[model samples]
Target chain A: MTTAPGSDRSDGLRLSGISKVLGGRTIVEKMELQVSPGELLCLLGPSGCGKTTTLRMIGGFLNPDAGRLTINGVDHTHSKPERRPTAMVFQNYALWPHMSVAKNIGFGLKVRKLSADKIRQKVDWALDLLGLQHHRETMPARISGGEQQRVALARALVLEPEVLLMDEPLSNLDAKLRVQVRETIREIQQRLGITTVFVTHDQEEALSIADRIAVMNNGRIEQLAAPAELYARPRTTFVAGFIGTMNTLDVGPAGGGVPLDDGALLPCDTFSGAAGDVCWIRPEDLQITEADHAGSVRAVVLRVIPRGHYREVLLQSHGSTLRAFTDGEPDVEQIVGLRATNALVYADDALVQDDEPARPGRAVRAVADSGDRG
Target chain B: MTATDTAPAAPAAPDKPVTPSSGARSPRRWSMLFMASPPVLLVLVFVGIPIVIGIAFTLGYTGGLNSIASMLSVSVYTANGWMPSLAAYGNVLSSERFRSDLGVTIWVTVLTVAIVLVLAWCIALYARLSGGRLGKMLSGIAIIPLFIPVVIGAYAIRQFYLNTGFLVSLGRQFGIQLPSWSYHTPGIVIGQVWVSLPFAVLLISSGLAAVPNALIDAARDAGASLGRSVWSVMVPMTTIPTVIVATFTAVGVMGSFTVPYMIGPTSPNMLGVTLQATFVAYLRPQDAQVIAVVLFVLAAGIGALYVWANARASRSSAVQL
Candidate 1:
């Protein structure tokens, strides 16, 4: 599914059964992906989830222990990084400190043995495109970090490679700059129509920029879908939880219905396949109402934290704690009802069936500790 | 475009309203000056006094009153002819023996600095890139010379390169006639390089440490080979450290006596050896003093370059931060 540059109807980049073993541990496992021309696909996951490793493999910085990578329909699994038609904007923005901004951006073109005029034309275009024209003659060290980040993007774009890879490109920037630079990157990607693979731990960044998001954990893709589809109908528990806050409740069959914690039996017909399924309701989807309102579960408010746009209300039901977002302030210790909307159900730990169930218990406990620590 | 419009523009301004806290700050400033006086006084006593005495001696004013007058009145020193103090300097500068000695010193310094810098760069780059047991061992071996006494190291080098030295004997055992390298310019340069290598390696290795691995990776991703990446990226980025290495090595080699004295040829000697000979063997103290001043000036000129390089490095780094 690879096609050369300027070819139409191309599968921009594909990874089939790609796996990587590092330090006797599989950092990436059997990752399969396909991106159409002019699409930005994000590898979204928490730290150590093999997202960066996958991006590196795609960029030819790391070789897959197994499986193959095809770019524009040609096998590049064993190609050296320089030989691949891929460019990466490193997390640290890796701009050459000794070079001027123009030199840094034109380095790749120069390496390709382009004529000075050709290199200058492309570099100047990138400089104007990224709004970095004023800083072209300044040394990289003299510019701001946000400006350096743009220079890094310009450098990669000057090559006009088939696939652009970014490893948390905005991570080094301040919060305000991160959003600003992120939008700049999105605009550039759309304008150039270069197939792109962006790796980031920030779910919002992925949701805002990517045509599709691949939620990964423990070296495997948990779910790969459009951001709305993944958020509204996550295929797995990890995907549901990682993409955003998911209030997961353990469910079991009781008579003809699935029983929840607060004496409510959800209709079993919708989740008939799995016996021990986990229901995932996003915090925003869980509407908090007065106790008198018709609801799925009754809970006592534990705390309320205002999040500017909405107030996050924490609730306790039986032995489980759940969170919900509300527009109004919910009093602490007040009994309230939580109604789930757009809830999803997945067979618990199905992707990791070979893993022991005992580990999840410890993982849950660790999550609790970290939650309390925060 | 809207993103740029709303972005928190550069960093926050560093300005803060200043209050006049003279009562609190004056005592702290005075205390700082007081604590800093000892080293300043020590340098004035040791280095400053000797340089003043040496300048007076070179001006042909050895007596206390005449030296004081020479220091006070520059015209008195220059009254005989233009720059009368430069007579001894001119005599030494024109001497055939001194000219050859100066050339020898310059050649040895240049050769030693070049060799030492190359060796140090290779070793340091190896250590930085490999980062394995071999890398650690190479790094350890590079700094071993630093712990060895220079005299002992110089003597060891002489033994290794002499006609009946270890290398020649080893060659003889293999039925080879190896050329004797004892009492030669190359022999002196070898000794100087060996002694000067540790500091150069340490300086350059620290620079290599400061280089982020990602920058090299970026260069590689830009289609540069490993060697090209190092040459274009690492070499340019570490210019200050390299300058520091070259300057320090040159100064060390220019003023060095023990290594050259131990292994260098007796004829066409370096400045260090010739200065000793001029003062002790020929009993020409004034001429030797002239040579010493010239050598000091040459080393000081290099030292000034090092200071400038260091300042530039710091200024650029500050801008980066």
Candidate 2:
């Protein structure tokens, strides 16, 4: 869905069959994506998954070996980074160490040969926008880490780039500052309604900030959906594992159930389609209870790692080890019964639809887009 | 020369002990003084004292160390009751020959520094951006001059640009009359540039290479062209090292004797050759020492510029950190 910024700006980023090969290795496969104006789409993946490569290509820093990249109906596949209406906030911020904060923000305008008054006005506005007015005279190195990051953001935002690209921009910040800055970025992106592509390896970060998350693996997009949609109906095992903690058990038709390590058949004919199918369960969906429940598989609590808001219980099952999230801690070595609810099933590395069909993966075409995500 | 060689570098020495204040008598402070004494003592004895005594001799102190030189000279300006005489300074300063030599020396030093810096920046920027084999080879080849003995290099350069040299002969083949640099001001400039290039390239290239790639990329992304990015970002970032090369090259060229003596014109010469000719050929020892003092003052001006540059760079960088 699109948001309010789409109302004023008609520009959107479109990449069709884009591919990149670096050093004889295909860093990004034939990736296709269309980000609506004013939407913040995250290229979410682990290291070397090509998410950053895709973002770099979109930013015009790197050209796609194949495929066409268009923005606002204009082809810019071979355009230089400056020629394209895109600005990137690099992982390291890339602020000019020699320039003051105001100068750093105004550098793009200065390059455009804008009048001094105009450049200064825009830089001041950017400083106020990022709440960095006091740091105008400060050098990048003299500022604190968070302040440096904001200056980098202001430097990009001052350009009013049509497409905003960030390469792990929050990775340099501490955990506390990371959340704060990401929220700030999200608010700014929404308020401005610029089409933004954020690349990150942190799944939680993607789930927290993105209008849609494109999960990548091995130079290909594994799944592209809203956070809830991805968690609920991950198209592949990789998506399920990458997006959240996934517990998979092999299913077969022998006992019309899933096969555990102990040769016990946990009946799952309702969720799976065929033999060798995988029953994917998110930790929270796996109900581990002290008392035996209907259709429950016997498991032993091996470890309990308290995770602030919830406890993560590692269980030794009949056939394999499985992890389940619980509110209360279960004693190690205590036997428990676990049952899956609303689990996804996959066969041959693909979703095997049995009953719960995925919600239609369609975005609002620049009309209904909002910062809100399911 | 030996003192500069034996002294530890001033900056970023890992074990440089900090001085303890308020008479705390820290072992580290003692170590700092001890480590520092060798260069200080050597410079004071071998370099510093001689310079002072030489300056005194120039000011008409023609006794003890100056006695031997005073006996050999014809018109020695003698001091009165320990009062220094300005007659020797007046004699050297008033000479049209000495004035011409000073002017030529300044011009050559300035020209050499400018050319060397430009060439070094070209090579350094090429290596930094393209990182191609050709740039590296060119940079490596530039350093060969540093290894070659200056006398041999100067002599070879003179031969290559002589009136009947290979370059002149080649121009003759094309029916062109090319002016030779031999026994000319341009010849000294060329020789100085050639000899100074190795250090310039070495420092400047490394300084440029040390600039983070992201800053350049960011500049390019900000709509600056490659040249603009280098001018605005890389140049300012590399001020200290570049200034160091510039100052050192100027000093080296100004005080250089071999290249100027081997290649420059006999008259209207750089002060390096004039100082030699005055003391040895004409036997005007006091006047020559006056010229030496003049040369030192000029070089001290450049050295002061270097110190100011270094201090400003450190101040800015320290604030940044």
Candidate 3:
């Protein structure tokens, strides 16, 4: 496969302006991308965002109506699925019901005309890799869901494909098992240095499992960057809102600052441009303080939710609701102040600036967690 | 069965794991049996009784209900006191005419069932995989015979292949020659396949429909060609319906009367025609009853295969799930 591991320039897999139209609807637009050798890239988007469609095109299951697909620098746009060096783990874990776990893992090898000894050795290796040796001869239907998932994974991995594709492999699992398998998949992908294209709708899963996350919306890639970079520097309003929970306030351009809903000018000093039209504020960055403090907006507490480790106090100021995380059990209707100098300012759906940082001295040290549930 | 007997039967695990209803189970059992009794009783009185009487008559018994057939037939084998005789069986089985007729019956049945299965599987598999106007039209053509009565279909099949009929005349007009096969076993097989195809296709296609597209895609992605995928995955998954089609077609062809009588030749005709000839033409009711018994036993043997296949499919699916 000419797979030079750690070679960032090697074209492990590339989709040059690929597109798909299903039933006369453009499901995936020009999707230009490249997966370097041994890199794991996640297609993160909501349902119907064409993540799975793109993955299928990459795997040769669905041919793109336009553009080309290349694996290892060879054009494979019109190749059949059997001719492509790619394997996919389906969302439902579509293991052959009639075949045992070992046979399923060995199926591709058998199709490749491998000897019996070679097939058995590869199957045994995969079973051990997935920790399914005890259930080697068990049929797919006889095993538990998690075990079936592992079998599906091992079946794909045994082929040693040039590029591995997964279409929401963890979407069928329970929350706890989803986390466990997600880590297992990531660890194996890293250990084997396989170039992978994983598609999932869960943002947290993409953030945790991907080396680089491609946030897609409306059949277009909104942003493609590392997990931390994409989270910190979301280029679009959709990306900012989609990556995490944030408060959005529509503000019009005004002299020296942006105007709020209540006709009060919320001073956005960090915004140097004259076209800032919306305000984005992370709840964690808001310092709970008194209204009389400098650079703080006056507000009234609308509701307080007990988010397991911290309290989420929703404050109303200038006719807009702002959420802030705090430890104190603030009563409803209590007046408070929210200071957010690091508020992400946007203009016409594009990020303008979020240059300033939160002043920790005045900030109420929030637990800095997002997984806690009320 | 009463609730007490149903308890031990329940302990013997079923193909499906039955939930123990514990409290309402006994009353529920009684109601189920009471509701089911009418049909069972009707079958016992009407169908079940006649079969037993017919077998007794074939075994050389000339008593009770057998007295009527023995009195009417030209020759009837009478049983000795307190013992069933095999004279009627030996008398019919040893005859060269009956042996040849039995051979013709089995040959036609096996050939018809095989052709029906191959054609039905092709049409259904094509419709399922390629799914469009052409596949639908092919299925529609196969099902057209279902709408036509067996009498009309058999007559049409025979006439269409005859030397002096429409097809031969058309071939003659084209200055081409073709052999007419009507009044032969091949013609009878053609007629039987045409009549049996609709049932087989409907059943087999329903099974193929249950095979999910995801599994097929998974197979293809695993480097299996279309043929291998169908053989390994689709065939195994649809075992129950396929078994049902085979057994039903075999049973239908073995005992069928209309198609064979209309299309088969006279000398070595299928047992269905031979049985009628022995009973009415030859005035030998005992010999005809013997042929009927043989056909029933053969059909029942095939039926056992269906039952075994069905039970195995259910048990395997249950365990897998």
Judged by DockQ, which candidate is best? Answer: 3
Fraction of true A-B contacts recovered by candidate 2: 0.73
Q: List the pairs of residues colliding in candidate 2.
A: A1-A364, A1-A369, A2-A369, A3-A369, A260-A319, A261-A318, A261-A319, A262-A318, A262-A319
CAPRI tier for the interface of model 1: medium
Query: For candidate 1, what is the TM-score?
Result: 0.87
Query: Model 3's lDDT to the true fold?
Result: 0.84
DockQ of candidate model 3: 0.69
Clashes of each: 4, 9, 1
Every candidate's lDDT: 0.81, 0.84, 0.84
Q: In what order do the candidates fall by DockQ, top score first?
A: 3, 1, 2
> Which tens-of-lDDT digit does each residue in A239-283 have in candidate 3?
999998787778744443334575654443344233567767677
Q: Candidate 3 regions off by >4 Å?
A: A1-9, A253-258, A265-274, A290-294, A353-374, B1-28
Give the DockQ (2 decimals) of all models.
0.62, 0.57, 0.69
